[model samples]
Target: MTINSAHRFEPGATVVRRDIFGDRVWTAAPRRVIEDRGDTLTLAHWPGVEGLAPTTYIDSLGMDSPAARDAARDQGFADLASGAWELGSWRWRDTTVLSRFQAGEHFSVHLFFGAGHRPLHWYINFELPFRRTALGIDTRDLLLDLLVEPDLSAHTWKDEDEYAQGRRLGIIDDALHAQVELARERALELLAERQETFPTSWLNWQPATDWPLPELPSFNGV
Candidate 1:
């Protein structure tokens, strides 16, 4: 059940990702709205949530060698930065996440869950503040993230190299880079102060078992 409401989209509405570069439709992953408190919007992502992905990412998953996969993983982000990849399907497999976005905030806190719906940790996704689009929201991921322990005892910055690459490729401009730095501090402060945004009670949060998976539209065979 939702606490406060803003009615941006009804529960189970699809949210498309609008690219920061021009008006290109980069990705669209359909998610069910969990709550909408005007200030904060929550969306649920479950397994089989299909959306756009770099083809190299799909290819890496099947590689037999760990080194090869790692190399491919690195290349995938490079491909994304260069706009040299095809649009491929990416499914959220074997996990769940509740993404909470606050208006004008440069970061979104994503609560991750594992098997049996156990709260695993929080993923602080540093990105551009969402601009409402016709489909849902328009925000570009900054290629950097922070992973916080479930208990808030520890945190780590993830994908720093990729983020640096983003800077080199001009994907993240000077202004956006400064914004990310500020957002990083804000995320740490929230974690350090044990803010309500990262509620501990939600460690066991799970949706109704009967709820069906959200469907991804084909965009007329994109």
Candidate 2:
């Protein structure tokens, strides 16, 4: 799909970091568009959902323990009654995510924070390019990911088993697998060389209390 210039976000626009499925909604407080340089967008995360309620009690309870199953069922009903099925009440610590989508490249550098908003590690997600729809832009997360320390002193791969499982299930094709691998390698190189793939200034940033909270759009399917 052609990238629509009109659909590009502007700085200060309230946006969300959400997955294709409406189930996993993050940034409930609505991440502000700190930088919207056409091809890239930097978002400053605010307090948001800490955890999402389980969809199925059966799935949540691995072995079908009767007590656990009953508890999960009750919780599910309570969540539905309270209308908390869509968004949880858990708050997020300080965090920031820088997204880039140029040509066919799609990735995000997520920075986690500790106490006092101290810089923590970076979680890099490589994924498919975003497709903008009427509701919002949507992208699917690939199985592979990378982890880098705050100092950029070391880096490691993450979710290798999941990636391999996707390949085995024919979900991740050869081309996509190679693409993700290359993306991981590129991330390692950047970290090793101390390259600034995303703005470091956002590491210490926080959102204003008056910033609007994000609401999930109606998901009719993509």
Among the numbered candidates, top lDDT falls to: 1
RMSD of each: 3.6, 7.2
Worst 10 residues of 2 by lDDT: 21-30
lDDT for each candidate structure:
0.77, 0.59
Worst 10 residues of 1 by lDDT: 1-10
| Positional deviation of residue 44's Cα in model 1 after best superposition, in angstroms | 0.4
In candidate 1, the residue pairs with backbone N, CA or C atoms under 3 Å apart (3 or more residues apart, or in different chains) clash, namely none
Model 2 agreement with the true structure over 88-166: per-residue lDDT tens digits: 3344434534444443565677777666667778888877766554444556677678887776777788878667766
TM-score of model 2 (CA atoms): 0.69
